[model samples]
Structure formats: C-alpha cells, structure tokens
Target chain A: MSYDFYMPVRVLGGESVVKTQAQRLREFGECCLIVTGGSGAKNSGALQDTQDALHSVGVAFEVFDRIEQNPQTETCRQAGEVARRCGADFLIGIGGGSALDATKAVAVFAANPELSADDIYKMQLSASPLPTVGIGTTAGTGSEVSGVSVLTDTKGVKHSIKGEQVYFKLVLADWRYTASCPYSVTVSTALDAFMHAAEGWLGPKCGEAPTAFAVMCLPILWKELKRMYKTQELPDSEQRKRLYHASLNAGFTLNQCGTLFPHQTGYILTEHYGVPHGRA
Target chain B: MSYDFYMPVRVLGGESVVKTQAQRLREFGECCLIVTGGSGAKNSGALQDTQDALHSVGVAFEVFDRIEQNPQTETCRQAGEVARRCGADFLIGIGGGSALDATKAVAVFAANPELSADDIYKMQLSASPLPTVGIGTTAGTGSEVSGVSVLTDTKGVKHSIKGEQVYFKLVLADWRYTASCPYSVTVSTALDAFMHAAEGWLGPKCGEAPTAFAVMCLPILWKELKRMYKTQELPDSEQRKRLYHASLNAGFTLNQCGTLFPHQTGYILTEHYGVPHGRA
Candidate 1:
C-alpha cells in the first residue's frame, strides 16, 4: 500500500524532439561532448539531429565515437580526458546502452580527472559530474531513464556504477531513432524490454508505481512479441513506435523495481560467450 | 504517439514518512514557514510530525495557520511577507487543496515582494520562488504533485496561477494523515479524486502516461465509490490507504492531462453557491 516516486528526468517525446527542444541544452552550458559508438549513432540519424540541434543553438561540441559494446571503464576514462581537454560543459549520449552508460562514467571522470578508472565504482566523487542528455537509439536498454550504468572493468568483469548522480538531466526520446535497428537487433532488444517488465513485475520491490508501469507496457510488449514469433518479419514504422514506447514504459518499471536474476545472469553470458546482453 | 513527462517532485510515501525522511528538508535550507488552515492540519497530526521533524534536524520554523477555504491571494501575500521578514528558506504546506495552493503562491510572493497579488497570474516573477514541501492531509486536491494553484482574487473571482516554478520541490505523502478525516470530508475528497481521473482520462492530452495512471487509479476509486454508495459507513485505515494511493495516481494523471469542462464548471459552484470543492 506504500510506494515512493522520484523520477527527476525531463523526458520529451515525439518526432524531431531533439531539434525542436534544443534550447533546453543551454541549461547545461555552452560547450558540449557528443558520446557514441561506431556507425549506430550516425546511421540512426540521432547524431546528425543532435549536431544540428547544437549548431542551431550556437553551442560548440566535440565528437567521441570510439565506445564499444559492453563499454569498458578505461575507454570511458579516455573519453573523459578528451572532454576535460576540450572544456566540455555537458555530454550528450546518442546511441544504445553501451554508449549511454559510458557517457555517465565519462561525465564523472571528466569532472574528477584525478579519479582512476576503478575509482568510479568506489561511489565517491569530489566534484559533481557534468550534466548528461540521453537520446536513445535502441528500444531495449531503457538506459535513458535509468541512473544505473553497467560497464566492464580492465579485468573484463561487468560491474555497475549507479546512483542519482548518473541519471540523465534530460532525455529526448524519438522512436524514429530506433527505425534503423535490424530485425535481429529489434527482436533481441524487445525481448530485453519484455524481461525488464517481467522481472520488475515479479520482484519483491514491485509496488504501485512499478505495477502501473508494468501493466501499461506488458500488453504492448506481449502483442509485439507474439507478432514477431508468428511472422518473423520486421516491424513497420507504426509497430516500431509501439515497441519503443513499450520499452520506455518498461524502463520506468526497471528504474523503479530494478531487474532480478535474469539480468544478473545475462551479464555473465554477455562477458564470456559474446551473446548480446538482451539475448543472453 | 507523442508525449512529454516532467514530474520533478520527490515523493516519499508511507506512515511516519515525515519523521523518517526529515533529512531531505535540509536540502532546502535552515528555516521554513509552515502554512496551513487551522484544525485540519492539527487534527491530521501532520503539523506536529512536521514540527518534530524540523526540531530533530535543528531547522527553525514559523507557523502561519491563517489560510482559509478558497484561500485569498492577499492572505497568501501576507504570509509571504511574514516569510520574507523571517528570512525563511522554504515553505512546508500541510492541509487540503486550499492550504497547499496558497503555499505555492506564497513561495512566489515571498521571492518577488515587488509583484502585487494580481501579477502572479501574469506568469512573471523577478526572482526564483522558494522551494516548497507539500504534506497532504486530504486526498482530494492532489496539489502536492500539481503545479497549478487556484486562488481567490481581491474581486472574489477564482483564478489559477501555474507553471513549472510552482511545482513542489518535495512531497511527503503519508496516507495515515487522512485517517483523521470525518466521513463527509472523506467522501467529498474521494469524489473529487474520482473526477480528476475521469476528466483526465477523457481529455485529448490523455497520452500513454496519463492513460496508464488513469487505468491504475480508476478501479480502486470505483470500488470505493461503489462501497460508499451501498454501505453508509466510513472507510477503515486500510481503505483510507487505498483511497489515498488512488488519489495520488489520479493526481499524476491530472498533472499530465489536466481537467476539462466539469472542473471548470465545478469552480463556479464552489465560488458562487458555496459548494465544497470536491462536491462541486
């Protein structure tokens, strides 16, 4: 009968939200760092839109596009060094979970250059992290709404750095960004989103807020998954929009109740067997 | 297919949340002004709990308990003057809709003393409003979560002052506070909560988020309303908790989609015919 709610992220959804709402970026500062992985951001059109928005708002930016799958802490530290050298006032992450997770870590590293790669997990930061804006290109991770960032250490172990500080200051969620996902990626990510909703629904921490989010998303995910299972066809634009919105709802559930055994176990398969995190 | 979500209030729920989460108040500042209507706050035990919490945190406070039903803008202005004179850092509103609504105006007036009461509706403020903490003693108004505040003007017309600036910084939603309500107030407030969900559900702006909230709260409200219709009895503590939670979910819907014709017409009944706001 009791529940707590504290989502502070300002999420703007719709078509061309990034360009239309670009002025919101000025609240962070003048200079910016754009963080992403190879090809995904550029191919999805999120990166171009973000750059255009930054240009339209007259803000300067630097692009760091070397992040890889299961983002490594050292790579994030390197990006942080670049951000510090370039005097970036904020960071905009424009890809899937890996890129967004690395962006959160990079913000911390950029703000506290003295902190080594391992220091982020210690949960102590001498200065506040740079503000972060998340433009999600994948429907699966729901990392845009979550403060938790799962990253790989130098030893190749998947670990999570999580707290209120890592939550995005703003999220520009355009389902069109996910239109570029291939069939396999689309199915895998939708499965991941389903698991997020399912796990959170079953968890002991599931309360009124989480239950509401789960109820809202489960039917949408179930219908899409059923269609995918039966047809083995790529989703149309309208279906893609539904899946993206469902994932966002699942993200809200995950943000509240968190995931259980499957998510924890999935990370192991991702690290050892090279399975996609969602498929794992 | 398009939506925007931006609720920034940190809501802490459950019994005795005020005492348990008092440390959050420190984030606002060293001193506070406690605003309320006379006996409802005292009867609900919210005022005493707030005082104890403030004392425990070594934060000084002043109590301004003069707010009345359909609270006047001038009264809010006078309270703001008191707050300004005392150099209060924040405002804690405890009571139903009127008191909480007044607290929002007081925050603005306290910050911008030069602005007359009429100027609040103009949506201009020279200074940033003081942070507000809302403690709901009644379930109906949902002012704890909403940014809009309805006030009575000098000419006795009802006007609403609203924007992101008026949103509460924190909301302590302890359902037990409603346990002291009499049967009449309880039924009236429950009806108001139900109307909020219904109006928002039917509104054009009822997107996924608001629709989800409406779905979650509607069934609970229906069951309670039906029970009240059949049985001429007051709700027990457990039922009270359910009702309060339903009201909060409805509040989220109202926050997102807002109200429609019935709410606009209800204001007229309350203003001219002396109807209770919820009943109106």
Candidate 2:
C-alpha cells in the first residue's frame, strides 16, 4: 500500500498548558492579532491568559472578535486587513473551529494583501502565510492541529481551504476551557471528535500511524462520552483532558487520512440548518 | 497526553513505483546526484530503473556509489563535494540505510559547503539541506521515510544526525528490491525493524500515533519472522511486500517515539562483535 503522511502543527495541551506554552509565541514576530468568536474566548478566560502571556513577553497585540460560526470569507479578509493595518506579525486563534479556521484565511490575506477572497478559494498566492497559533476552547473540531479552514462565501456556500500552508505554527490547547461550555455544545462537539476517529479508522486512506491515533483516541473519547451522557455534566478534569487530547489525536489522523462522506455531508447541515460546526 | 508529531514524506510503494514516481524528481531541481553503497542498487535493478526514470524526465544526474555500511562522516563529506562539483541540485538515495543516511549528510554539505563534519553533528548549518528522494533496496532501515542519519566518526564511534532537514521529500519503496537480499541479511534487517517497533512501542516518548504504527508493524513482523525462521528461503513476494511496508511503518514509529536501550546497546555489538546492524 502507498500513502502519504504529514502534520507540521506543534501542539501543547493539558490543564494549564496555555499559560505555560504561550511563551512560544515569541517565535513569531513581535506583534500579534488575536482572533476569536463572539464571547467564547473571553468567557473561557483564554483571551485574558493569552493577553497576559503576550504582555509578559512585551509583544504588542490586537483582538479581532467578530468571527461567527461557519466563519465568513469576507470576515476573514476584513480581519486580515486589520492585521495588516496593525502591522501584526502573527496571529493567535482562540475559541472553537470557526475562530481557528478564520485565522488561517486571515493569515493568508495578511501575508498577501493583493489576493482576493476568490484567490484564496482558488488557493492562488505568492507567499507563505504568516505564522499562526491556535488555542482551542472546545473539545472537538481539532482545528488547533489542522491545516484546514472551512469558510462560507457571500452566497452562503461553504468553501474549504486546505494543505500544508494553513498549518498553525503552534497550538496551545487547555482542556479546562471546555468546562464552562453548554451541555449541548459539549456533547455535539465531542461527537464530532468521535466521528473523526471512527470514520478515519475505517477510511480507505487509513495508514498505520493514523490507525494508531484512532485506536488510542476512540477508547478515551468513548469512555468520556459515556460518563458525560450518564451524569449529564462534564467529566472530571482528568477525563476532560483526556477527551481534549483525544480530539487532538483524531485531528492528527484527519491531517493525514482526511475524512470521508460524513464530513462532506456535515458541511451542508452546518451551512444550511445553522447547525454548530462541530454538531454538523 | 500532549506530544508533537510530524512526518512529511510522501511514499509510493508497489513493484514499479520507483519508475512511476520518479517524475516527481523534477519538482526538486534540474540536476540530481544518486547516492548508493556497493552493488545493492545495481543487483536489485533499482538504480537502472531510477536512472531511466530520470532520463525519461530529462533530468541530468550523476552517480556517487562509494558509501559503506555504518556510513562514515568523511565519506559523506566527499560525496557532498562530488554533488557540489557536479552541480547536482537534488539527491536520490538508492540503496540500504548506509547509502540513504549518507545522502542526508551529503545534501547538508552540498547546500552549505562552509560547514564541516563537526558542524553537521552539532547541527550548526547555515541553510537547509537540498530536497531528497529515497529508494529502499533493503527491507530494513525505514530511512526512506525518516530524516535521521547514523554515521560513524573516525573514532569508529557511531553518531546519529537527526532533524527535520533530513526528512525525505519523496520515498519510493518497492519490496521487490529486498528479494535479492541474502537470507542472513534479510533476517537480520527484518529483526532490526522488529526492534524498532518493539522499542518504540515501549519507549517513554511513545504516543498514540507511534503506538498505532507499532501495533500495525509488530504483528506483521512477528508472522514474517516465524515463517523466515521456519524456512531458509525468503517468503513469497507478497509477504516480502508486507514485511517491507511493516519496516516502513516501524520507521515512522521510530521517527516520532524513537528507540530505547536496545538500539543504544545494539551499536556496541555492531561495532565490537562485527555483527550486522540488524542482527546486533
């Protein structure tokens, strides 16, 4: 069997990993653009922690908080313009898949301002994207460790921009952020993580490494899901961490093998029915 | 629960994949240098096929076929000089571990001639190594998909040079090549591959992805080992392919988790007792 595997995104995860790991942001330049959806990053305290980390490192930063579910292509371009205006050297995406996905497109535009939204969808660009950091607040999507961006065009058609170019330079994931998430959001997102592993495990592109990721993740996620469903509350901190890392592992699998029919079909629900990105 | 994983190699397997995939060589550059050790490549017909593929694509290349087992630093430097003198833009490694390992070091020197052997060992290079393509002639050493080079110094002490710079851009693995390997060599190499999986599976650095690779490889290697031990002759071509791919999978595991005490201790047996690399 012949196959290909690659995942360049560096991930640091745990309870307080964001505080400890955010120091790596120094590897990117001096200024930063923090991207997030409505109130997720703020509510989770991830935004404050990230700001503190940047402040401690004496790096300048600006926050762009307009990202919405099923991030819009136009919003990403506007964020890119903000980054360019502020002379932001890098980007930090904090929140769920929408925020993280939007950051990738924003970085691409910030790096090449001449490129249009259509150019981005077409994937025509002259330079590499600015370095980006992803700090996930949700337990699914695994966007923190993926090089894929799902954005909706003005026509409400979802478009995916993928490849190595979109891979985040660093990913800081703290499981505690999901502790405050709503039950429905938590369960749906967790299910999305499950599907990533289950589908990837059975996919035609499955390889030894990806299967290992699946084997390791499926058990942890299943156990946590069972506990959450029975208790109707989030699992303990330890289990929460396990679920979060399991999602990251599944993301790594998807990075190599990619998803099959389910992901493609899920996109339709997300775009039309307004289903949450993870639930769809 | 958090670990970093990355493997950028694109692998193409099958009896004639080398010829089919060599067209990708043009992506690296105009001219190339083919690195090999002894007659392994010629005996397996891999070198001729590689040359024909390059010729068909009209890419100029030169052969530097003087690598020795347990590749030496001096020899690699010499090969690098040959590559630079020939104006080779990229490198094709076509043999067993020694040749593939040497190609990595040679590519390093060819790109930055100012650096010495000491600099390479210290990873004090000025620029990235040239792109590399690996073709395996042995079922052992998954060097085709890894960016690790184990070279011996003048003191006869084995030193390992590893980094992202050494990762092959493309890997062409064909099980048919190992069909020509002698019984002793084949068994030894296969055992070495087994050790890679076993040790990596048990290492402290072991992660989900690496464990998955080990899980897939261990069973295949075990079954093949039982058969090889039972009969003096090589297994059928199909089994050989399985064994070869298993070795590559083990290599992927080692690339992430790395080997432990066994690999460290095996070096001594190879250096002192003159045991073959895999047997030791």
Candidate 3:
C-alpha cells in the first residue's frame, strides 16, 4: 500500500515540443553537445532547429555528427573526447537511440576521463552524474525516456550500462517530428516499441505505479504499431497522439520495470546485421 | 502533452512506514497536527505508533480527534485555527479520506488566515498550500496521492479544492492498517477504485500513461473488489496486494485523467445527504 515512485525525467509531449527545446535545454548547464547521426535530424531540420533553439537560449554547443547505428563504445569515447575538448557541460541526443546512446555514454565519460570504451563495455566504471535530454526523430527505442545506453564493443559484442537510477533529465516527445522518418525506420522503431510495451509488462517485478504504467501504454502501442504498418507515414492525429503517449508510457514502464527477454533478444539485428537498434 | 503531474507527498509502503513517520513529521514541520475520525488509527495504535515514529524523529504534535464522516468544512476550519494557535507546520491525516480531506483543508486554511468555513461554501477563498501526508487506514479516496481536498460546508453543500496540492508531504500506506476499515468502507472505496479505472479508460484526452494505468488497475480491482464484497476482507496476501496496488493505481489514475462525472458526482453524497463521505 505504500511505495515511492518518481520520474525525474520530466516528460513534455506533443507538437509544441519543438518550441520548448531551448527552455528544456536551459535546465542543464550552458555548454552542450549535440549528438547526431546520418541525415535524420538534419533533414527534418530538427538538428538545425535544435541548435537554433539552444542558440536563442544563449547556450554554446558543438556537433559530433559522426554517431552511427548500433553505436559502438568507441564512438562514445570519441564523443566524450569531443565534449571534453569543447567544454560541453550537457548533452542533447537528437536522433534515434544510436545518437542518444552515444550521447549518454559521452556524458558518462565527459565527467570521468579515466573510463574508456572497455570500462563502459563492462559497465565497471563509476562516473559523476551528467544531465541528458532527448528529442527523438523516431518513435521507436523510447530512448528519449529510458536510462539505458546500449553500445557495441570492438569484439562486436553488445553491452549496456544501465544506471537506471540516473535516467534522462527531460524527454520531449513530438510525433510530428517523427512523421518524416523513412518507412523502414518508422517500422523498426514501432516494432521495437511494441516489443518494449508487452515485454515491459511481463518482465519487471515493479510496483503498482509501474504496473499501472504498463497497462496504460500497451494497448495504445499495439494499436498504433498496427496503424504505422498500414499508413507507412504519420498516423492519424488521434493515433499519433496515442502512439506518442504510448512511447512515453512505454519508456516509463521499461525504465521502471526493465525490458523483457524479447526486447533484449531483439537487439540481435543490431549486433549481427548492422540494423538500427529499433529493428525489433 | 503539456500536462503537469506531481505528487510532492512521498510514499512509504508496508510496515516500514512506521519507521519513517518521525522523519516525515519533522520534514512536515516542527509541530504536527493529527486529523482523524472513527478511532481506528487510534485503536490500532497507528496513531500512537506514528506519534512514536515522530517522537523518535523529534516532532511535536496535537490531534483533532473529532473529524466526522464526509469531513465538514466547519471541522476543517476549527482544526485550521487549532493548527494556527499550535503553530503546526505539518498535518498528518490518519484514517480514510474524510480525515485526509479534512486535514487537507485544515492545512490550506491554516496557510491562508483570511479564509473561513463560509468561504468554502462560496468556493471563494484561495488558500496557500501546506504539507500533508496520509496513513490510508482505509484504501479508498486515492486522496493520499492526489491533489484534491473535499469538504462539506455547514449548509450541507459539499465542495472540493482540487489543487490544494499539498495534503501530505509523505503518505504511509500500511496494508496492515487497512485491516481495520469496516466492510462498508472497503466496498465504497474499492468501487471508487473501480470507477477510477473505468473512467480513466474512457476519459477525455487521457494518454497512454493513464490508459495503461487504467488497464493494469482495472482488472485487478474488478476481481479484488468482488472478493472483498464476498468475503468482507482480502482473503490472502495476493488478494491484499492486488487490492492495495489497485487502490494506488486508482489514485494514480485520478492524478492524471481525473474521474468523470460519476466519481465527481459521488462528492454530492456529503452535500445532498447525510451519508458519511466514505459510504457515499
């Protein structure tokens, strides 16, 4: 009958998310790192738009646009070096999980120079907490709201540093921003989200709060994952709203419950096939 | 998407709740105001036990032992003035929602000296927020985690100040304490939980989070409420946990999508008739 449930990742949902990036960014320190990959965020003008938002807020930033799919811990090491060199105090992970995952590790390393790619790979290092926020241009991963940052090692084995107690500081979920994702990427993320919702429900021995969170999120995601498979584009507004919230709830669910085996097992596509992390 | 949700009142579940009472009281204020009715918390030693917790934590206190069914605003104001004279910084609402509701208003009126019992009838006075926490003694109302306070005015008009925002700084929900609520109280509160789940499922503009909250809570409550009705008590630990979690999810649901007319209409029980707030 008694439990403490708190989500430090202040979640802001919907269309106005684009406009609030700057204000959200200001919640962290001024010097920032923008983690991105390929063309998604840049093409949607999301990358530039985010820079503009932070610029208006008077935050200085540097861009490490070399993040890649199934981000390797080495990429994280590089990003951290960039953050250190640029004196960035905070990170804005601006694409899908790859970019965000990269930023998450970079944040870990920005504070602890002694920890290398291998240390993070083994999840054996300790580092001071770093603030992170996300604006996903994709609907899958739910990375914008999760505490996990998955990366690959030089041996091509995948590793994850799960400091769930230290999750994102803010998550801005804008379905509209994700509308422009290619059909395949959208499908990949949607399936990943689908897996996350169901598995999250069955996986964790979570409390009433997180159990309630799963119940709320599952049906909506099941419905939207279907719709996304059909329309191959932005879902209807109602569905968009539904999926968007599902993503947030799913994030909250898995964040609390931890993911189930299917979700964990689903990551094979990334490790073996070079597919996006969301290819569940 | 821009919706705001916070339960500043921290919660500690299980027998451990007794251990936190003192620290919670000190955090609440230097002097504590205990609000309750039906003598259950007192009889069960929950009241004395909590006082012992607070005493160990070095907190001072007083009690309003006369809170009645439905919790009249008159009682609230009286308790408020008592709090004022006592210079209490925090209120501990023991027992069910009546005590919780009355305590909420008591804290409010104590904070805003200009308000009177009549102001509640007109819904005219704005009271400042004060710290509050609850010992659910009964599992109904979801009041422990919600930002609402309901009271009946002298003229038999029931009113609520939703966003009093501070009812308790910490909620101690010990299922063992819920063991003492009467059969009728159990039925009504469980229905209140069911109504919350049903309403949230179909509620206006609710998100995946609340939707998920409804789904997980509803099925468990539907089953548990029936069991409680048939047996007049939770028959086992599993059923007890189910009911306890359901009660919490019910509160979480209200925290997000707020109950529609049916639940809100229940407030009229205190206003239109003499039904105890719990029975109505």
Candidate 4:
C-alpha cells in the first residue's frame, strides 16, 4: 500500500558504451581509481577501453587490480589505501560483482580514511563517499545499478551495507565483457539475473515500479537463457545486449525491493559448496 | 539501443494518500500556494483532505482556484503574482491537468518575477523554480508526474515549457477525485493514458525503461477502459484506483519517451475541433 521509489543512477548500455560515454566520467573528478579483479577486466579488454576513454578525456587514473571473488574487507581497505595514496578523486569499478561491491566499500573507506573496515560495517558513515561509477563487465549481480555492497569480513562472515549514498552515480554496461566468460560462468550469472527478477516480482515489498522492472527483465532473461541452453554456447552480440540490459533492469528492481529468502539461503551454497555466486 | 533514464518523483496512490502522506508534504515547504480549478478539487473533497494534512503539520497555505481547461498564460501570471505577494515558498497543485499545468508556470513566474509570460515560453529561467507537489484529482494529462507544462500563450497558441526543473517532487493521487468525474471524462482520460503507453511503445525514441513503462501501463489502461465501456457508469472505488494508477504509469512513460506524432497532431483536435485530449 505504501512505498518510496528512487533509482537515481544513470545507466548507459550498448556496444562500446564505455568508450562512448567516457567524456561523462569527467563529471566525477579529474583523477580516478579504477577497481578491477585479477584478470577479468584486463583479459576482457574492459579495463583497456576504460583506460582509453579516461585518456581521451585528459583524466588520469590509477588501477587497483587485486579485487577477488566475494571481495574481502581487507582487500577493500588495501584498495582504499591505494586510492588514497594516488589522490584519486573518484572510482570506476570495471569488473563483475566482486569488484563493483568492493569499490563501494573502498570508496567509503577512501573518503573516511580514519575509519577501520569493522567501523564501516558497524556504523553509518557521516561523510559522503567518493563518487563511484560502475563499468559492468558482467551481467549477473546487477551490482552496477545497486547501492548494496556485500563484503566478507575477517571472520569469513558476509555482511552488507546499503543506502542511496553507496549507489553509483552512473553505470556503463558493456556486453563484450560477457563474450569472454566461460559457459558455466555465463549461465550462472544469467541465472542470478533471472532469480533477481523472479524474486522481486514475487516479493511482498514488490510495488508498481519494481513490478514494471521485473516484467521487463524476466522475458528478456528467459529468451536469452533459452537461446543459451539450446545453443550450448555463448550468445551473439545482439543476444548479449538483451541479456545485459535485462540484468540491469533486474538489478534496479532488486535495489528497490531486495531479494527474498533465496539470496540469504544461497549464501550457504556459495560458502560451503564452493559454488559461484550466480550458481548459488 | 541507447537511452537516458530518470523518473525520480514519488507517486502515492489510493483513496486517502493525501491525508495519509500529509507529513511527507512538509519536505516541500512550510508556507505553500495551493493551485486548483474552479470546483473539481473542492467538490471531490481533495482540497479539504489537503487542507487537513497541511493543518496537521502547521503548514500555511493560500489557494488560487481560477485555473481553466487548457490553462492560459495570463491566468498563470496572475496566480504567480498572488503567490509572490503571499510569500509562498512552494506550490501544491490539486486538481486536473490544467490546474497542475498552470501551477508549474505559476511556480516559475513566482520565483522569477522579472520574467513575462512570453519570456516564460521563449526562454528558460536561469534560477530554479519553486518546489511543486501534485495532488491529482483526475486520472488524465499525467501532469502530476511530468515536467512538461502546456500553457496557452497570449496569441492563444498552446506552448509547452519542459525540463527536469518543472517536475514535481511528490505526487498524491486520490481516485476519489475521479469518483466525481462523469463517465465520459473518465473514459476520455483513460483513453489518453492508453495513447501515451501505445505511442511511447512504438516511438523511435523509445528505450528499455520507457518500453518497460509502456508495457506495464497499457494493459492496466486497457482493462479499465473495457470495464468503463461495458458499465456505462462511474466505476467502483477499486476500479477508479486501477484507472488512476494506470494513468500515472502512462504519465511516467510519457515523461521518459514523450508522445510521438499523436500528441503533436492531437493538439489540433483539442484546440480547434473541441475534442478532449484523450479522444484526439
């Protein structure tokens, strides 16, 4: 009967949107911290595209390439230190869920350097985090358009921080990043996107806006998933584009209504069974 | 293939949302100018609910109830002068499309008193306009959710001023307002909502978010339209609520993609042929 709605992030999608929208990165600041995983962003050429875009705009950037799966709090703190040392004014997260999630925490810790990682999970930040932009290299987590950041703590417990302050100011979704993903990785990630839309649609908190997002996303995801299952291969560029946009829609819906029991229960599968996040 | 998306306005719908959401109005301002048509808001009890809510919060307000169908520039200027004299800080638009449209213009002129009505249409104001809250008493026009204000000029031509600046910060939609609307008005307005969704879906400028909106809206509008045509009488409260929400969805879609040729060509039907906008 009652709900508050806002999806303030601007999402740009298509082939080469990252390069096309490079000029917009200047709005964040003059200097940037590019956060990525071990080899995903680099191998996929997403990092190069981002770097080239920043270079074209006359903006300088430093890369923090050590973000890991289910990004650890310690890793975020380490990345934040690098960002602080580089005097980076903004952050561009250029990999999958882990990098994007870690970037939000890193942006916060980088802005509030005096605070420890535990303090981030325990207390609300008084200071605004550095403006962060998401260059989504994968379509699974929908993290590019979400404000929620899940990071594993020192005790191996996963904790999440969420608020409007943590959302990326802009998102660049480039489907080419998924072109390099292993079939298992691609299926799992695409399933996660489907789960988000399904859960959001059935969730009690689901309202008109979120429902619209779910309705838009699920069909596209279903079509792409069907094609992927039939071909037993990676989708063509056009199909990937549909899947990419569908994932963004699901992420936006999740941002509004959140995931239901599956997300919480699925964590056990991820931690205990060594399942990939999307598979879990 | 490419798009920019934002529909940040919070829409509260149902029978008593104005009274239920009275406290939220405080976010707009303390002192307010309430704008409306001659009798729509009053006869529908929407004005009284608004007054009760403002009184509960101790917010002061003045009413300008002279807005006509296809709101005029001169009327808006006069209302702006009254608002200026009263030292109102924000505006509450509480009637149909014309009142809501006029309120947007009044807010702009009230903030920038130096500008003439012609100037309001001819040039964008350098300063931001007063914050506006819309309490939609009718289901058509979607003015409550849109930034475009269609105002008739001194030459009697309808000119629109549109931008993010004119968008309402909040919208309160009470189907009770449409409870009093004649079946013809209800059907016509509902048709207008349908046209927006259809046109937006088919438009060349349409993108993912707008297409999502059009998809969500068109079905609800069609169902409501079918019910109205069969009943040939005012709908029950539940039906009215569905129609109102559908109209708001249509308005949101229109805000995103805008109406293509039908809206522009339909203006002639409204202006010269005496057709209701939805029918046109």
- Per TM-score, the best of the predicted structures is 1
Q: Could you tell me the TM-score of chain B in model 3? A: 0.88
In model 1, how large is the Cα lDDT of residue B110?
95
lDDT of 1 at B263: 93
Q: RMSDs, each prediction?
A: 1.8, 2.2, 6.4, 3.0
B202: Cα error in model 1, Å = 1.1
Evaluate residue A259 in candidate 4 and report its C-alpha lDDT on the 0 to 100 scale: 92
Each predicted complex: what DockQ? 0.76, 0.49, 0.25, 0.43
TM-score of 3: 0.69
The TM-score between candidate 4 and the true structure equals 0.89
lDDT of 2 at B195: 89
- Model 1 chain B worst lDDT run, 10 consecutive residues: B1-10
Docking class of 1: medium
Instruction: Judging by DockQ, tell me the better candidate of 1 and 4.
Output: 1
Q: Candidate 4 residues B149-206, lDDT tens each? A: 9998888788899887888888887777888888888888889889888887787778
Model 4 per-residue lDDT at A228: 85
lDDT of 3 by residue, A53-84 (tens): 88888889988899878788888888888898
| Residue range B37-86, candidate 2, lDDT tens digits | 96999999999999999998889999999999888888898888999999
TM-score per model over all chains: 0.96, 0.94, 0.69, 0.89
TM-score per model (chain B): 0.98, 0.97, 0.88, 0.95
Error of 4 at B87 (Å): 4.9
